[model samples]
Structures are given as structure tokens and as C-alpha cells.
Target: MFVQEIAPLAGSLGLSALVAVLPLATVLVLLGVVRMKAHHAALLGLLVALVVAIAVYGMPIGQAISSGFQGAAFGLFPIMWIVVNALWIYRITVRTGHFDVLRRSFGKVSDDPRMQALLIAFCFGALMEALAGFGAPVAISSVMLVALGFTPVRAAVVSLVANTAPVAFGAMGTPVVTLAQVSGIPLNTVSAIVGRQTPILAVFVPLLLVIIVDGRRGVRETWQPALVCGLTFGVVQFAASNFVSAQLADIGAALAGAAALVLMPATRKPAREEVRAAVLTGVATEQLERPEDRGEVLRAYLPYLLIIVIFSIGQIPPVKKLLDAATWNFHWPGLHVAGSSGKPVSGNTFSLPFLNTGGTLVLIAGILTVLALHVSARDAVREWGATIHELRFAILTVAGVLALAYVMNLSGQTTTIGYLIAGAGAGLAFLSPLLGWFGVAVSGSDTSANALFGALQVTAAHQAGLSAELLASSNSSGGVLGKMISPQNLSIACAAAMLPGEEGTLLRKVLPWSLGLLLLMCLIVVGQSTILSGMLP
Candidate 1:
């Protein structure tokens, strides 16, 4: 068994932390500053992590290789699987031309660019995040924004930014569940704590998206809708997570946000210049003028409605239990790694939840979408093939970064860095969230981030006399902001936006928001540990 060592480099915590960070730093700087293609950066980052694990951390080569493959398998099967099928649903709509009609329906609601963004990126994106997270919201929402006439890059940025508000409870509260399990906190307590935390982000993210999409002019014209959307989302999420169920939190918030916007005073149509820009972008801008036929409108909306209905049914306790039974679990071959306490890491055992995953559920939705949209079976098959082909590099990028994360994690590189940060003691209240942010920035998964550091957060909190449950739950809250800049997410958004090689551009654009919000979460955590103790469950 390979035992983790938190201070392996010459038995020095500070020195080990610096060396431990090289692989992650290599990834971020190469992807963000050097403007490297995401797959290339990710693979190179994996290579660096491999060397660090063996040379510095003393992880055996056999277990190291096995761990890398295990992570790569996890990424491709359940994670990217969700994205592929979700995009296929989008492509099926495109095949029927219903996607354009859906776009026009948004124009019918409010052709104001700002309002369109509020609906698609924030409201709709939150709904998607609720049902099927693991990159599904980014992939589908970014493409929907493009169809709504936002620039490709802007759509990507908007989708990435909009994703943060609902993520702590994403995938039916997977991240929070993972955190509670790892941290030894009660699920309700962790859920309640994160419920209080992420809603704060929910209140501000819509305003931030407006600022990103339209600057001051957009905010000036549409701040009312943005604020309404954000407020409703935040309020509903808080209620659902604390009072109802964390699994239903984002679903409730998203539906409420959408309803609030629809009920708001209608805004004006897109301006002449906006129409011209849409035309230049090949948007068939004239369709906005078409009088909506009732049946056509229903057909235009059928696919998404179908997705909601199917996912909701799948979430029923009995149905979910059945699906859960179909999953398989096994220890990864030739890999055994224990933490400093000599317990085996849960991550080293792989669970293949083929039936329970959102990916399979999305596939069911795609099949139904094919029938509802009247898409030919032949065409649907072709689109699925095309989806796989289109996301080849994105698939590689996801797998590579996940492998890098696993290599770092199983080898102790990640814990070394976590220990260095946790060493901050009472200042840990101020710095607690960074461990999660760093984990997510590396793995592109808040769920994975919690799995990596949730227990560590609780352990550190105990040592520092802080609230263990609060700090543990805060790991997930802080990790949400990192989603925008995660290399895997960057690749997924770029792929869906059809800006395949622009991951670096997208990273540079979203990095400021990610860091800025992470700082805000840090302060919130510190306050919760002291003055804001009433906020805790």
C-alpha cells in the first residue's frame, strides 16, 4: 500500500507544498497565460504530476499509473458521458429546426439582449445544473446562448459564470453529499450550512453575468430583471435546501427565477443593430418576426420540457433506488493508497453508476427528443457520432485533467498543498475555501474537490477550534466559483461554443470572476466562524 505523506519533500511542509503545486501551476499558467490548447496543457500537466508523485512524494510507479487510468476512466464514463448526451439533445433540437424556434420564443419573451441572457444563462442554466451537472449546464447552456444571438465567446463566458449559483446542490446535491460523507458531518447539517452559503453567491451571480455580457449600459437597462432573477433564485434555493431538500434546491430556484422573469414587465425587442449582428452571425434574424403558431411553440419547447419531466421522474425515490441497484463497484486494479492515518482512500475504489448517472438519463431524453422532434433515427445516430467526434479533444482534456488530479491526489501532492494552507490555524477561517477552490481548479469538479479535501477541512477546523461542519460545507461553496476556470469545464464550454482552441481565451476572461468570488467566499467563511455564527445550522 502506498501511504500518503503530507510533507514528503525533505520532511518540510513549506518546501513540499511548493513542489506539490508545480503540476497544478503548470496546468493553469500553460492554459491561461501561455494560451496552450487545453488537451495539450492537460496531458503535459499529467506528465508533470507523474514525475512529482514518484520523484518527490515517493509514490510507487505501479499504483501511480493505475490511479491515473482510474481517474481517466471515471472522467470519460460518467462525466463526459453527461456532456455528450446533453449536447446530443441540443443537436437533435437543431436537426428539427426547433432550436431556432426556441431562440425566437426567447425573442418573443424579450428581445433585449440583457433579458435574453438572464433567461438563458442564469435561469435556464440553473435548471440544467439542477438536473444534470457534470459539465452538462455549460455545454448545453453555452450553445443555447449562441442560438439566442450572443457572441460565441460571450455565450461561453455567460454560461460559465451563470453556472456557479446552483452548483453546491448540483447533480441532486452530489457535492454536498460527498462533503458530508467525507467530513463525518450529518447530511442535514452540511446541507443546511451550504444552503445558507451558496445562496449568497446566487444573489450576486446574475448581476455579475449582466455586467460581463453588457457592461454598464446593459446593467443600467436591465438591472431590475437581473436583480429579480437573482433574488428569487437565492430566496428559493435557501428555502429548498434548508426547509425542503438540498437535492431539490436548484430545481426550485431555477423554476422560480424563470417564473419571476416571465412575470416581470416585458422588455422591448432586439434593436436594429442587434438584429444585424445576429444576421452576421448566421442567426436567421428575420425569424424573430414570425408570428408564433401555438403548436410550433409547443414543439419548439418540447425537448427541454421532456428533459425536465424525465429527470424529475427519475429522481423519484423508488426509481432512483432501482437505478442505483444497477451500478457496479470495484477496487481499481493494482492501486492501493492510504492517507496519513493509514485508512484506504475511498477514491481508489471505483463506482460505475452507469444506470444512475445523468448521462444515461440524458441519453433517454435524447431518444425521446428524437421522437418528439421527428428527427430521423439515422440522423440521430449520425448526430451522436458527430457529438463524439466533435468533443474528441474535450474528452481528452477531461480525462487528462482528471488523471492529473488523481495522480496528485493519490500520491499526496494535493494533501501537501492542503496541509500548508490548513496550517494557517485561526486564519484557516479566512483561508478555508481556497483548499476547495484549488481542488476544483485542478479537477474541474466540486464533487471531486469535496472528496479530496472535505475531511481535511473538518480536521483543520477541529485543530483550530473552528466549526468543523461549517468549514467542511464551505469547501463545496467555495469550489463552485472555481467551476468557471476549471480546465475541463473550459474545454467543454469552448467545444459547445464551437470555439475549440479558445480555452485559454475563455480562461483569461473568467479567471477574474472566479478569483474575485473565491475571495468573497473566504471572507464569508471567516465571518461565519466568528461574527456570523447565527448563519450556521
Candidate 2:
């Protein structure tokens, strides 16, 4: 088998690293600057990666092609699978006329746009992220905000920003689990470090959400509730991740935050007369027409309740083992090459874990939703087909991006780039989380980002005399910010908002927030590495 080369361009690491970054740069410029569609940008990025791997990196064309196919297949199976099914479930709810009841129920909670954003976009969105992730929170919450009368752009932006805090522990803590596996760190230790870092952000994310939703006025009117929500979520997340169970940390935190919101008394002073009149008129219309019924409310929430139950069942060890027993695992053909580290590169394989995967659980939840709602199988099938049709572009974007990631990784281009960044030495602590931000910005999955950079972060931390756990955890915490700008996520937000060609606008809206939060995470990580070294568990 052919071994990989980290510095393939005249043995110059910097030049090799620049060549390695061509694919990522191509995507970013095409999407963010040139305003290309996400799928088109991803395709162009994939082509650039292929050229770099074959020509500059000297990877055999056959192996590069095989690796790309492998990554694309993975993107379709679990990633797209989850998104499509989650949207389909939502469609079923809307079709059964239950979503209206759900919206009205939320209106009953608080009709203020700012409060709605906090309750739905931030609090409920975190719960979705904790369980499903992979665009589920954005897709579901953005649509909910739109139904609640937010402008499409505002809804998309709020959902994207709100998605940040829970992301590190998202999809049943998959990102942290991947970090531990790749970095050779204990799961609990990595989880604890991440817990310490992200909870700080979590405590302020609701405030950020309110500000984004209604600017300074939003924060002014809602600071008490926002603080209550954030503090509750952050504290529970910290406790659960460090003291209880990392896997269930976000679940506990989300529940606590939601409970806190439900229990807290609304104390906002009355709006100005006209504004209060408009708000009351709207709430009166909704309540008069929809009239929330307890059963309908339960049914409105049943799909998500089923989702929690199904996912929890799938996580049970014995049940997980039984389900995963049927998983398929195999090396990709024609890609059995090794990396510069003497480890197999393209030949690395993972179990498909079809039955136990989060996507499959979501799919099962959708099926059960149909049964519970008593919808005809024909209608359910139609909605599923419609969900797929709507996500065609998203599928292409995600698949192409994953293919590019795999090609760069297998050809050793990623290693060259990573090593170049790691060369920052002691200063690398400040830049460590940015590495994860870059990875997630490209791959569109925090789990994938952790898989890409977790080991690299550990290696760099050793060289720089930094805390490996802290830096590795920073990779995940920082990646949460990158999700807002990820092309795949942008596509999901756009589609959910029914503004397919407005991705650039959405990216522009969320980019500053993403960068600002990433910078904060960098400061936190740098502190943990030096002055706050005592914080490491």
C-alpha cells in the first residue's frame, strides 16, 4: 500500500499546507463571497480536493476516488437520513393540524416575539440538539419561529445562534465521544473539560438569543428570564457532565432550562399601548380560534416525546448491542493506504450501525408518529417523499463536502495543514479552538470536526506543553460556533425558511456572532491552558 506524505511539495510544509487549504478556501469564497449555492460550492470544493490529492499530494486517483465515495455514502446514510426524517415528522404534524395547536400553545406561554424566541428557539432548540442534532434543531426551531411570525431571516439567524450551546454534547454526546476516542483521552475527563468550557457560554447564550431576536430592547425586556434560563441550563449541564453522566448532560440541562422557564413568573412591564394592543389581539385571535386542548397538546408533542423514548431505548447498552450487531463494517476498496504516522489512512473503517444510528431512531419516531396520529401510510409516504425533494440540494451539499474532507484527510493534505497550524507552539493554545472551527465549518458536523482535529489537538498540546484535555475539549466547544456558518447548516436553515437562494445573506447575518463566540472560546481555552490550569479535571 502507498503511504501518505505530509509535506509533498518540495518538502516545504508551508507550501504543502497552502495547497491543502485550497478546497476549504474554494468552498468559503464560493459560498460566502461569490454567493454560490451551497451545493455548487461543495461540488467545486470536492473537485479542488480531488485535483490537490491527485496532483500535489501524489495520491493515486483510484484511492482518492474511493475515499470520496466512502465519505459521500456516510453523509447520505446517517446525516441526510436524520434530516429528512426529522423534517418528515414535522410535516406529518403540520398535516394532522397539530402543529397549529403546538404553536398556539407556545403563544399561550408568551406572545412576545422575544419571549417566543427564547422559549422556542433557545430552550427547545437546545433540547432538539441534545437528542437529534445534525441540523434538526435548526430545521425544527427555525420553522417554529417563522410560524410564530418571525421574519424568515430573523428566524434562521435566531435558530442558528441558539444552536451553539448544546452542540458539543449534541446527538447524544457524539462529539465528545469521538474526541475521547480519537485523542486517546478518558471520556469523562474530556467531557468534564468541555463541560467547564461550554457552560460558561451556555450561561450567556439566551442573552445572546434575546439580543439577536430584538436587539437591546429584547435584552432589556427579557433579561431576567434569559438569565434564569441560561443559568439553569449551564449549571445543570456542568453538574451532569462532571458529576452524573456526560452522555445525558445536555438532556438534563435542556430539561432544567425548560423547567426553569415554565416555572419562572413573567415580570416584563406592559408594552406601549399600541404594541400591547397588537400583541394581545394576536394572542386573543389564536386562543379564540385554536383553543388549546390538553390531548391535542400532548399529541402535538407526542412525536418529540416518542423521539426521546426511542433514542433513550437505543442508547441502552444491551439494546444498542443487539441493534448494532446487524451493523455493516468494511474497508473502502482501492483505498488501503497508510498515513505519515504509519497508521492506515484510507483503509480505516467504521460500522454503519444502521439500526442504532440517530437517523434510524428519528426515522422510527416518524413512523410511530404516523401511527399515533392515525395518518394514512399513503400520506406519510407522500410527506417523506416531499421532505426528500425539498432537501435534494442539501443532500448534494453535505455529500460533496464530506467527500472533500475524506479526500483531503486520506491524501495527507489535512495532516500537512494541521501540522502547519500546530507549529504555532505555545501560542497554539489560542488557536487550538480555531482549528476545530475550521474543521466544523468545512465538514458541517462537530462530531466530524472532533474526528478530524481531536488527535491533532492532543499532539499539538504535548508539543506546546499545554493541557491536552483542555485543548481537545476546546476543539468541540469552538466547533459549536462554526455550525452557524456551515454550508450544510445554512442550507438547512434556508430550506426551512423557504429562502433557498438567501444562504449568503444568512451567512452574513450569523458570521459575526459565530466569530465573536469563537473568539470568546479561544480566550477561555487559553485561560484554561495557563492561568486557569487549576480548572482542568
Candidate 3:
């Protein structure tokens, strides 16, 4: 048994920690500094992780190979599975001309491009994330943004930024659920705590969106719309996560925001012509031209409706049981190294078959969408092939990032880095969100981030005399902010936008805003711990 010693540089803890961080640094340098393509950068990062895991961590060759394969397999199944299906759904709509009708329907609500971005990319995407996650929001929203007349770069940027706020509670509350499991906190407490922190930011996200899209004067002009949108989203997100199932939080908030746009006059603001003129340079006005078929528009939207229904049915007891019955779970052997006391150091590994996963649900929706659109089988197959071609690079990027994440976690280097923060005692509260931010930045999913650090946060909270639930929830909430700039998500957004080779520019644009919001989340968590005890669960 190799018990880790927590010295600065003379121990396995210190060495492992440095080894873990090297790959991440390689990612930043390769992508941000060298301006390499995302796929190439990701591959380089994965190589670094593999090398460090073998040489520094002293992990057996077979165990290391097994870990990488496991990570890559899991990445492809659920994560890539969701992306492909969601993108396929979008492709079907475009190929069948139904997306034109949906675009027109949105325009009928409000001709303002800014408002459309808010409604579809932010609000509607949140709903999709709540329903299917695993890259669904980024997949759906980025394409919508592009179709709405934004340049691919701008569309990618907008969708990535907008997707951030709802991520922690996305996909039937997976992130919070993972947090609960890892921290050993009651699920209700984690939900309430995350709810308390998320909605505070939700209140300000619309204002932030306006600022990002159209600067201060533009935000001033759209104040009423921003207020209505933000409040509706924030209020429902706050209420549903705390009072109802956390799984329903983002979906409820999104529906409420969409409702505000549909029913509330003040929520649909007409962007001033002058502001539109300034930002619409080099853009063909044809892209923003509204469609004329309202009935057809509703019909065009059946796929998304079916997505919600299918996802909801899959969550039901009997349906879920049948699905679970079909899933194949396999335990990984030979990777568990026993401790001195004879307990295994590594946890059990299991694989749930793809057909039973959230990704498969999205895939089924894509197929149903194709059928509803009445496309011929040949055309449908063509659409699927084209969709795969479009997203191939992104699939590679997601796989690489997930592999890097697994290497970090298994190497004990992440723990070494966490222990550095945990050593800060009371100061750990301020750093908690940052740790989670780093986690999601690497992993691109809050569920993975929470699983990586939730227990660590609990331990740090106990040592620091802080609230364990609050800290754990804070980690999840903070993870949302990091989602905006995650390389995996950025890659997905760029792919959906058809904006290849510009991932770095998008990252630079969104990084400041993401970091600033993360700081605010940190403050909110600290305050919840010290000032507003009753406010926390």
C-alpha cells in the first residue's frame, strides 16, 4: 500500500499533483498560445496525461491502458451519443425546411435578433439541457443561433456563454445528484443549496447577455425585456429546484422564460434599427427573413416536443425499468490495487449500454423527427452521414478532453492540487468554486466535476468548520460558470456553428466573462456560509 504523503515536493502527493496539471497546461499552451486546432490540442493533452500517468503515478501499464479505454468508451457512448443525435435532429429540420418555419415563428414573436438569441439560445437551450444534457444545449442552441443570422463565430460564442447558467442542474439534475453521492449529503439539501446559489446568478444573466450582445446602451434600451426574461428564469429556477424536483428546475425556468416571451408584451423588445445596423455588418439580411407558415412551424416543432415526451417517459418507473433491463453492466477487473488493510484503492467500474442512456433518448428523438418530417429513408441516411461528417472533429475533441479528465482523476495529482487548497483551512471556502471551475474546465461536465471534487469539498468544509452541503453545492454551482469556456463545450459550439479553427478566439472572448461570473458565484457561496445561514439548506 502506497499511502500518499502531503509534502510540498518530496512525496507522491506532490509529484502526482504536478503530473496531473501538466496535461492541462499543455492544452492551454497548445490551444490558447499556439493557436492549434482543438482536435490536435486535445490529442497532445491526452498524450501528456498518458505519459504522466504511467511514469509519475507508477500506475501499472495495463491499469493505465484500461483507464484510458474506459474514459474514452464512456465519452463516446453518452457524450458523443448525445451530440450526434441532437445535431442530427437539427439537420433533419434544416433539410426538411421546417427550421425555416420555426425561425419565422420566433420572428413573429419579436423581430429583434437579440431577443431571439435570448429566447432560443439561452431559454430554449436551458430547457433542452434540463431534458437531455450531455451536450444537447450546445448542440441545439449553437445551430439555432447560426440560423438566426449571427456569424458562426458569434453564434458559437453566444451559445457557449448562454449555456453556462443552467448546467449544474441539467439533464434531470445529474450534477447535483453526483454531488450528493460523492459528498454523502442528502439529495434535498444539495438541491436546495445549489438552487439558492444558481438563481442569484440567473437574475443577472439576461443583463449580462444584453451587455455581451449589445453593450451598455443596448442593454439600457432592452432593459424591460432583460428584466422580464431574467426574472422569469431566475424565479422558476429558484422555486422548482428547491420546492419541486431538481430535475425539473432548468426546464421549468426555460418554459417560464419562453412563456414570458410569448405572453408578455414587455418581454418582446424591438431592437432599435441603429443598433441592429451596427452589428449586422457583412451579414445578409436574407438570413433573418421570417417564414410565413405558423401551422407548419408548430408541426416542425414536434420533434422537440417528442424529445421532451420521450425523455420524460424514460424517467418514469415502468419505462425506466424496462430500459434498465436491457442495459449491460460490466465490472472492470485488474485495476483495483488493494490498500494495506486489504480494501481496494480503486472503485468499481460499470458500463450501462448506450440504448438505455440519455444520449440514446436523444437519438430516438432524432429518428422520430426524421419520420415526422416525412423524409425518405435514403435522404434520412444521407442526412445522418452528413451530420457525422460535420461533427467528427468535435467527437474527437470531446473524447480527448474526457480522457484527460480521467487521467487527472486517477493519477492522484488532482487530489494533490486539492489538498493544497484544503490546506488553507478557512480560506478554502473562497477557493472551493475555483477548484470546481478547474474541474469542469477539464472535464466539460458538471457531473464529472462534482464526482471529482464533491467529497473533497466536504472534507475541506469539515476541516475548515464550514457547511459541507453548502460547499458541495457551491462546487456544482461554480461548475456552471466554467461551462462557458470548457474546451469540450467550445469545440461543440464551434462545430455546430461550422466555425472551424477559431476556437481560441471564442475562448478569449468568453474567458473574462466566465471568470468574472465564477468570482461572483464564489462570493455568493461564501456569503451563504457566513451571513445567510437560514438561506442555505
Highest TM-score model number = 2
What is the TM-score (0 to 1) of candidate 2?
Answer: 0.85
Predicted candidate 2 versus true structure: per-residue lDDT over 1-537, tens digit per residue? 768897899999899989988987887788667878878987898899999999998888898898889768766876667667777887899899998788777756765677777788887888778766788889888777777666788889989999998999886676887677556698899999999989998888899987876678667878898899999999999998997656578878887887887676762333455543433222122332456779989999899788777866776789878998979988767777886877774336744777876678888888888999999989999999998897798789777876776777778776677677777887998988898898788667897777656766765676667778888899999999899999879988999988888989999999998999899999988888888888878
Which has the better TM-score: candidate 2, or candidate 3?
2
Model 2 / residue 278 / CA error / Å: 9.7
Clashes of each: 0, 0, 1
Estimated TM-score per prediction?
Answer: 0.81, 0.85, 0.81
* Model 2, C-alpha of 180: deviation from truth (Å): 6.9
Colliding pairs, model 1: none
**For model 1, how does the per-residue alpha-carbon lDDT over 488-517 read when each residue is reduced to its tens digit?**
799889999889799889999999999999
In what order do the candidates fall by lDDT, top score first? 1, 2, 3
Q: What is the lDDT of candidate 1?
A: 0.80
List candidate 1 segments past 4 Å from native.
Answer: 111-113, 128-163, 167-193, 208-224, 239-251, 266-286, 434-476, 482-516
- Alpha-carbon lDDT, every model: 0.80, 0.80, 0.72
- In angstroms, how far off is 475's CA in candidate 2? 3.3
Give the clashing pairs for model 3. Answer: 16-413
Q: What residue pairs are clashing in model 2?
A: none
